[model samples]
Every structure is written in structure tokens, then in C-alpha cells.
Target: MRVRLASTDDSPAVAEIYAPYVQTTVISFETTPPDAGQMAERIAATMPAHPWLLAEEAGTVLGYAYAHPFASRAAYAWSAETSVYVRPDRHRRGVGRSLYEVLLRLLAAQGYREAFAGVTLPNAASVALHEGMGFAAVGTYRRVGFKHGSWHDVGWWQRGLGGQGAPAAVRTVTDLEPSELARLLALPGERR
Candidate 1:
């Protein structure tokens, strides 16, 4: 498996990977699954600023991960909310972890100071994934959302990116040197 920058061309596969969770489980709070067009728009909007990554194996997308603005406030610029979604048929194959490892590194490289993730309650796999990735359980928002005909709690986890001293303005992914970016991204084997 290899991790690479996700493009709008990858949207259909990404959307396909995400739709089942939205349709059948409380793992995602979305009531309706976005189509490929919407997913493409999301990738276009998020990039330059944040990273969207996919893990591909044998020319197929096994999973994806990304980071987005944690809040609307200007003061929240240094923090990011992260998420990962793997194909349901390919869970526990290290695909999600491969995607996240690259996503987090790229976020830090872009000057992000911290990363946060929210897991809907009772998802041992998600909670374990975040904790295994060095995130600490910060707190939980009890009964925060109603989905699947029941109330659900969201547990937030945080990971510090080791940013220190005086702050510098964050750079977009587009601002990085192409060669370096390509080098950092070529992981778990080859680049696509």
C-alpha cells in the first residue's frame, strides 16, 4: 500500500468508501451521503490549505484521511480536525493508519500545531486508532447528536504536533516544494 495526495478524480472512490457509514451507522453524523460531485468540491476547497490523502493498494483506494479547519475563528488557525475513512471491506489492514501517518506529517509540515479527532461513542476501533496514533482523550460531548434513531455522544481526542516558540504563519500544501512534498509522500512502497 502507498499513500498519495487525493485528487478530485479520487472522489468517487472516496465517496463510495464513506457512504455506507453515513447510511447505516452512527459513526458519521451525516444524514445523507454526498455524491462524487460534492466530494470533489470538498477536495478542491480543502487543499492548498489542508491535506487530503488516500491509501492505494494494487491501484485501488483502500482508505483516505484528511485534516480541516477545526473552527471558524481566526485564532483557531493552528489547530485542525482530522478524519479517516477506510473501505468497509478492507478494515484493519493498516490502510487507515498509513493514510493518517502521512496526513499528520503533512499537516505539521504545513505549520499546524495540533490535531484533533472526534469519535462517536462506543466505536472501539476508532477510539483505539486515535489513541494508537498518539492522541489523548480530552473529553466527550454527551448526547450531542441524534442519529440512527438514538442519541450519540462524541469523544474528542487531541495530539500535539510539537510546534513551539514564536508562531509563523501556516503555509498551504501548494506552497511546499514539489520535490520535497513528493519525497515525503512516497511511503509504504511507491507513489501513484
Candidate 2:
């Protein structure tokens, strides 16, 4: 198996892994699954902010992971929210862990100070993955998200990227202008 940054070609496979979760489960709150083109655009737009990764085995995509803005305000620039999904058949084979390991390295390299993982309630595998990746369970909000005809809770987990103090030459993600961000978010290949 191999772990690497995803490209336009990986979207369809990623979407395949994501479809069932979006359609039948509350693992993801998105009600509609994005088409291949839009998923590719999403992957492209995250180039600067995060790294979208795929775990592959013999040319088959087993899982994917990525990070995105935790909040848009300047004060929240150093933080990012992470998302990871694995093909149901590939679960327990370490795909999610590999993807997240790569993601953390990429986020730190991009100068992010903190990373967040929000797991919708009852996702034990996801919660375990985050805890195993050195994330701490900050808390859970009750009834914050409603899906599947029931109230759902969101679990928050956090991890620090760098050492004790903030690094020098800080260029927060919010430092960029709206147009510049739009350009990044609108990049051709990956825009979910």
C-alpha cells in the first residue's frame, strides 16, 4: 500500500468511498454526494491550505483525507478542521492512519499551529483514529447537528502542530485577500 497526495484523477475513487457514508450514514452530514468534477475541483482548491491524500493498493484508492478552514476569521487562521474517509472494505487496514499522518506533516509544513477533528456522534472508528494520532478529546456539543431524523452531537479533538510557542514569520491563512483565497479555493483540479 502507498500514501500520497491526491490529484484530479483520484476524485472519482474518493467519491466512491465517500458515497455510501453520505447517502446511508450520518458519518458525514452532507446529504448530497458531489460529482467527480466538483470533487476534483475541491482537491485542487486545497493545495495551499491543506493536503488531500489517498491511500492506494495496486492502483485502487482505499481512502482519502484532507484539511480545511476551521474558521474564516483572522483569529482562527492557525487552526484547520480535518476530514478523512476510507472505503468500507478497507477499514482496519490502517488507511485512515496513514492518511492522517501525511496530513499532519503537510499542515505543519504549511505553518498551521493547531488542527481539529470533528467526529459526528457514534463514530467510534473515527474517534479512535483521532485519539491515536495524538489528538485530545476537547469536548462534545449536544444536539449541534441534526441528521437522519435525529439530533446528533459533534466531538471535538485537537492537536498542536509546532512546539510550545508560536513560530516566527507568522503568515496566517486569513492574511490572504478574498480574491486570492477564492483563486486558491477555485483551483481547477480539486474543489470540494
Candidate 3:
């Protein structure tokens, strides 16, 4: 298996992997499965500022991970939010870890100072992944999200990047407008 930056062609497969979770699980709060077009747009939007990485083997996509703005304010510019999803059949194969490794490196190279992960409750794999990757547990937001007829807690984790020579308190947090996300998403990359 290998991890690579995702492209437009990966959208449909990515959506297929996420659709079941959207329809059958509470891992993601989004209630409706996004169509391929919407998923493609999402891919486009996050590709620039953050990497949308895919884990594939023999041409089959097994998992994906990406980072996005934690907040849109310019003050939050150096901070990011992370999300990861893996094919149910492919858990524990290191795909999530591989994807996250690439995702963090890319974000750091792009000048991000810190990465934030919001792991939905009851998911020990995700929680372990973040911790294993050196993300410190900041806190958990109790019942901050609702899905599948119940409340869900979000576990927060933070990993420092870049700024090795700077004070941890000096990281900039930016509030990105939706337009910036859209624009960044449209930046060019190797198509496949």
C-alpha cells in the first residue's frame, strides 16, 4: 500500500468509502451522503492549504485523511483541523497512520504551525492514532455534536509543526473566508 495526494479522479471512490459512514454511522455529523460532485468540490477545496491524502493498494483506495482550517480568522492561520476515514475492511493495516504521516508533513511544509484533530467519541482506533502520532490530548468537548439520534463528544488533539525556533504561543490563527478555501481547493496538482 502507498499514500499519495488525492486528485479529482479519486472523488468518487472517496465518496464511496465515506458514504456508508455517512448513512450508517455517527462518526461524521453530516447526515447526508455528499454526491460525487460535492465530494469533488470538497477535494478541490482542501487540496491546497491542506493535503487530501489517499491510501491505496493495487489501485483500490483503502482510506483518506486531510486537514482544514480550524477557524477562518486570520489569527488562526497557522492552526488546522484534521479528518481521517478508512475503509472498514482495511482497519489496522497502517493506512490511517500512513495517510496522517504524509498529511502532517505536507501541512508543516506549507507553513502550518500546529495541527488539531477532532476524534469522534467511542473510536479507540482514531484516538490511538492521534496519540501515537505525538498529538497531545487537549480536551474533549462533551456532547458537542449530534448524529444518529444521540450526542457525540469530540476529543481534541494538537501537534506542533514548524515554529521550532519560535515560542509556542506565537502561532498565528487565521479565519479563512469560505472563498479562500474554495480558491485554495482549486489550485493545481498532479491530477492522479
lDDT winner: 1
Report the alpha-carbon TM-score of model 1 versus the true structure: 0.96
Instruction: List, residue by residue over 1-192, the lDDT tens digit for candidate 1.
Output: 888899899999999999999999999999999999999999998887988999888999998998899998999999999999998889998887778888888888889999999999999999989999999999999999999889999999999987797668999988999987987687756654
**Which model, 1 or 2, shows the larger TM-score?**
1
TM-score, cand. 2 vs. native: 0.84
Reference-based lDDT, each prediction: 0.90, 0.79, 0.78
Residues 1-192, model 3: lDDT tens digits: 767668778899999999999899888888999988999999888666667878888999999888888999878877889989999999998788878877776676567888998877888888899999989999999999888888899888999976665433331112344444333323234222
Model 2: residues with Cα > 4 Å off, grouped in runs? 168-192
47: Cα error in model 1, Å: 0.7
Q: Across residues 85-185, which tens digit of lDDT does each residue of candidate 2 receive?
A: 98887889878887887677667756788999988988889889999999999999989977889989999999998845655443433455655443443
Cα RMSD for candidates in order: 1.4, 7.6, 7.2
Model 3 TM? 0.83
What lDDT, from 0 to 1, does candidate 2 have?
0.79
lDDT, candidate 1, equals: 0.90
Worst 10 residues of 2 by lDDT: 183-192
